[model samples]
Target: MRYLFSFIGLVYSSLIKLAVLFNPKARMMERGRWKVWGKLRGGIVPGGRHIWFHAASLGEFEQGRPMMERIRAEYPDYRIVLTFFSPSGYEVRKNYEGADVIVYLPADRISRVRKFLDLVQPEMAIFIKYDFWPCFLLELERRQIPTYLVSSIFRPTQLFFRWYGGAYKRLLHCFTHIFVQDEASRILLGKHGIDPVTVAGDTRFDRVISVYEARKSLPLVERFAATVPEDGLVIVGGSSWPPDEEILVRYFNRNPKVKLILAPHEIDKEHLLQIISHLRRPFIRLSEATESNIDRQDCLIVDSFGLLSSIYRYGQVAFIGGGFGKGIHNTPEAAVYGVPVIFGPRYEKFKEARELIAEGGAFTVSSAEEFTSLIERLISDKGYREAASRAAADYIRTHAGATERIVRQIIR
Candidate 1:
């Protein structure tokens, strides 16, 4: 099984290298890991209590962030080592002040893993969400390192529970403890005879709440907020994709009275222009908007990053993008601010989105008609909107404290 897995990893790495010729992201992944051992050897400080955290991408990084911050605060002596499997996360947070060292995780081969373990000698290993590399887990276990999986969710369909999943199931045993997001995951792990599991909820709830409380003021967002009449609505389309923008553009065309803030997942010039071409209303890029003339535009197009979470404050309703594609983006970011959330129908994979929908805090739309109807109802009916807002806010308040729980267990 180990040999087979190693062969698979080699094939995957070679494919990524080949992909670098045409794919920019693939190029980043390749370039980021070029001479990665030297980077790791140089960055890691010697003779200190080292704690390592691994996240696959930006979403997992956010899920693991609160715990990372808490560990830094509580265990000041420990040097933090953060690793990302994807360039999307590493490129964005490579200079993060929270970690003592940040590096791209080397490909999970026996030799590479051994070298990495020898270099860092982490006192503890923490994998956020689900990016379990079999070789890495096996090597960590061989060294008897205390490893943990945090904010984890498991489904029955995963190979670990399958009849032919003996090799994959061994990966779960490597973890000293598994902190899951829900009871179903706990039960599932228990069914597999994996003991020492705890249902700690999702740490993202705590992170988003903190972000909402400590959100900074954006002058452009505030100016855009002021553009809408007192009774008018400001619909925030956050982390939106082209499909999401199409539905939003249709809605905007039909209802020009409502203002919009469009923040796409990608901020490329072509994507931004594609969105602008579809819109019938007067819109301005966030960079171009000023305090004096910001209110004159009907739409505010965000062509930059890092403001989507904070921008939820100015919205009465939020439409989180990516639901129409892979999955839904963060719903709790907007839900934490007491705004009703609406997203595409492909959100079942996200626990928060499903729970919000069940709690009446969020609505999912399968088509433009469903989206239009939901938006209209939320805007026109104050009572209905307020109920959804309250539900969303309450859900966030209740789901918080997961970080605290997980941190307490880890520190113990």
Candidate 2:
């Protein structure tokens, strides 16, 4: 089984490398790995008593962030080394404040894992959410390193739960503890004989709330936000996938008076062109627009990075994307801004999405017809929008502090 897994990994790796040659994100991937090498060789990592955190991408980083901050405050002497499996997360957060070092996890091979462990010499490692690298995890287990999986959730359909996944299921036991997002995940892990599981909710709630708290004093955001008409409505589509943008563009065209801000998940030329072509109204790319150009267009297509969270503050209705595909993007980000969120139907895996819907803070549509109708009603009716917005904010407030909970258990 291990050999088969290794063979599959190699094939997947080759395909990824080929894909990178044609993708703009390829540069970010190579740059991140190079950055990691530079940090390691330059002696940037603090030598003694280090804590390691591994996240697959940007969302996972947010899932791990609250715990990262807590670690910094509680164990001031211990250094933080954050590693990423994908370029998206590392490239965006390479210069993150709390971490002493941010780097790419070496490819999951025995030799690479051994070398990394020798150099980093971490006292403990935190695997945020679903990034489980077999060889690296095996190395950590062999070394008796205290490793944990935080904000984890295991579904019945996961590879580990299958009859062919006995070997992978054994790997779950490598963790010193598993802090899952729900009771179902806890039950699944227990069925596999992996104990020491705790229901730690999700750390993303804490991360988003912190984003809102920090936004209170940012001068640039205030200046940019002032350009928005004081009485006009704000609709923010954040981390929007292509399909989500298509849905939004059609909706926006039907109501030209509404103010809309779109921050697509990928800012590449291909996607930018897709977004531009779908819009019927006069729209301005954020990069091309000046402060003087604010009122010149009804739609502002954000082609920038790092401002999506702050832009949410100006939103009365928020649409978080990626739900139409595998899952949804961060709901807490929009909820933090106190807005009603609407997305597509593939949200079964996102616990927060289900909870928010149950609380009347979010709505999920299985088709374009459903999404269009819900969005129109929300936009037209003031009372309905306001009620949903308040509910969204309340849902977020109730879910905060998963980070502290997980950290307390892990440190113990």
Candidate 3:
């Protein structure tokens, strides 16, 4: 099984190399890894015991960020090496102040894994959510490093639970301990004989709480809110795709009592123009808005990054995008602001989205009619909206403490 795994890694590396020729994302990942050795050898890790944290992408990075920040503040003896398996995480947070070293994780092969572990020599390893690289994890186990898997959720359909998943089942043993998001994950892992698993909830709940507490104030967003009529509501469509925008904008054009604010997933000129073309109402780009002119705009287009999280606080409702496409963006980010959230009809995988729906705090729509009816009800019925808002807020409050749980257990 081990030899077969090595052969599979070789093929995977070869395929990635070939993919770099045609896929821009693959090229970015390849380019990012090219400097990994240089970064490791060039004294990126400071002199201290090292604690390594691995995340697969931007989503996983966020799930693990609160842990990094917590450990950095609480334990001064350990240097943090944060590695990302995908370019989306590394490129966006290369200069993050929480970690001593930030670099792309090398490909999962014996030689590369050995070199990586040798260079950093982490005393502890933390894998957030998913992205279990076999070779690297096995090597860390061999070294007797205190390794952990946090915010993990296991399903019976995964390879580890399959009859043919002997190798994958062994990979789960590499972790010193596993902290899962829910009791179901804990029960599933225990049924597989994976011991020392704790139900610590999802750390992202804690992360979003911190975000809500410390979210920055945007003058531009506040000014735009002032432009809205007191009887009207602002609908913040965050990380929106064309599919999401089509439904949202179509309803906004017909409705006079609601203002729409769109923060698209991609703010590239082409996508921005597509969003603008759909808007029949007077819309203004956030960058171009002013106190004098902001009043004239019915739709506020967020052409900037880092403000969507903060801007959610100003809206009466939130439309988390990408559900009609890849999935939903962070629903809790908006839900933390005590707003009713709506998204497209593709949110089966997200546990929080499912929970929010069950709790009657979130809604999903497949078309413009569904959205219009849902939003209109939430808008007109003040009691219903407030009840939904409280549900959203309560969900966030209860699910928190994962960071404190995981971090205290690891550091203490």
Candidate 4:
């Protein structure tokens, strides 16, 4: 089964390399891998005990970051290597400060895994969240390296829980410890006879709490706020998709005083044009405008990356996108800013969404009417807004330090 999975990984990697010729995102990943390899060749990690941290994408990167920082602090001699399975993670955080080398986890073929282990010579390996590549786990077991799965969340519907999941379930035994997100995950792993499980909760809660404490005032946002004095409410439509934009278009058109700052999931030219066409009010794209031009604009469409987290600081209410589609983007990213959050229904899978709603910091709407009505009321009622903000802030503070907890256990 491990060999079969390795062969599949080799084919997948080859396909991605070939697809890069036509796809820009794939090309970016290729370029990123080459850049990291360049740093490795320049003697980043010479002769030292090494630790490797693998994250599937950007979300898992956040979960791994606090632990990475702790390892750097605790073991000054041990080198750190960060590996990403997806381009979304590597592209955004290739220049990370904590890691000695940040590289793409090569295809899970035996030869590729051998090459990676030879290069890094990792004594300890940590896999974040739900990314479980069979060959990689098997290889780590064979090497006698202590492997851990941190902030893991397992559902009963997963392959490991099925009758045919015997081979897959054996993969769990490879790990020295599995630090799961909830009790349900702990129960499922124990049922498979993979004990030594700990419910560490989600590391995202810790990451968000840090972000909340570090929040600073943005001068540009303060200026924007002053310019739109007539606009009493600020509705930040963050990480919006086509469906989410459709919902917002109807609401934004009717309520003029409710100023908007929209940050779409994909900032392609066509998507930006689609948003402009849908909005009734005149708006300016942030990427195209000079500082002078934005002062007169009511709606500012952020067409760039890395600003959304800070932008949440300027908002009174935030509509996190992706709920109407496949899944929702990070709701806590906005919630940590202490603003009331609104999102479309279909968030039953997200534990944080359930926690937030119960705490009175979030409202999940099914349709345009519910969204618009909620926005109107949340804006007008200062008492409700304050209560929601308080709940959100309190929730973040209470659930922090999962990364610290995991690190302490590993070092023990």
The lDDT of model 2 is: 0.82
lDDT by residue for model 1 (380-411), tens: 89999999999999999999998999889887
The TM-score obtained by model 2 is 0.92
Local error of candidate 2 at residue 22 (angstroms): 2.8
* Tens digit per residue, CA lDDT, model 3, 97-201: 888888998888888889998899888999999999898888888889999999999999899999998789999999999999888899999988998999999
Model 4 misplaced regions, further than 4 Å: 31-38, 228-231, 288-291
lDDT of 4 by residue, 32-123 (tens): 76665566666455777788899999889988887887788887887888899788888889888889888887777888788778777888
Model 2 regions lying over 4 Å from their true place: 1-15, 18-20, 44-47, 216-232
In terms of lDDT, the poorest run of 10 residues in model 2 is: 216-225
The 10-residue segment of model 4 with minimum total lDDT is 222-231
| Candidate with maximal TM-score | 1
List residue ranges in candidate 3 displaced over 4 A.
44-47
Candidate 3, RMSD to the unseen true structure = 1.7
- Kindly state the number of residue pairs that clash in model 2: 0
RMSD of each: 1.2, 2.5, 1.7, 2.0
| Clash number by candidate, in order | 0, 0, 0, 0
What lDDT does each candidate get?
Answer: 0.90, 0.82, 0.89, 0.84
Q: Which order, best to worst by TM-score?
A: 1, 3, 4, 2
What digit string (tens of lDDT, one per residue) describes model 2 on residues 1-412? Answer: 4455556656655666677778756656755655666676564454678898999999899989999999899879888889988878877898899898888877665655677788889999999999788877877898999999998888999999999988888889889899998899999888878999999899999999988988755343344445555544667899899888877787778865566789999898988998888788777887777656655677888897888887888777888898888788888888877889988888888888998999999999877788777876876787888899899999999988899898888886
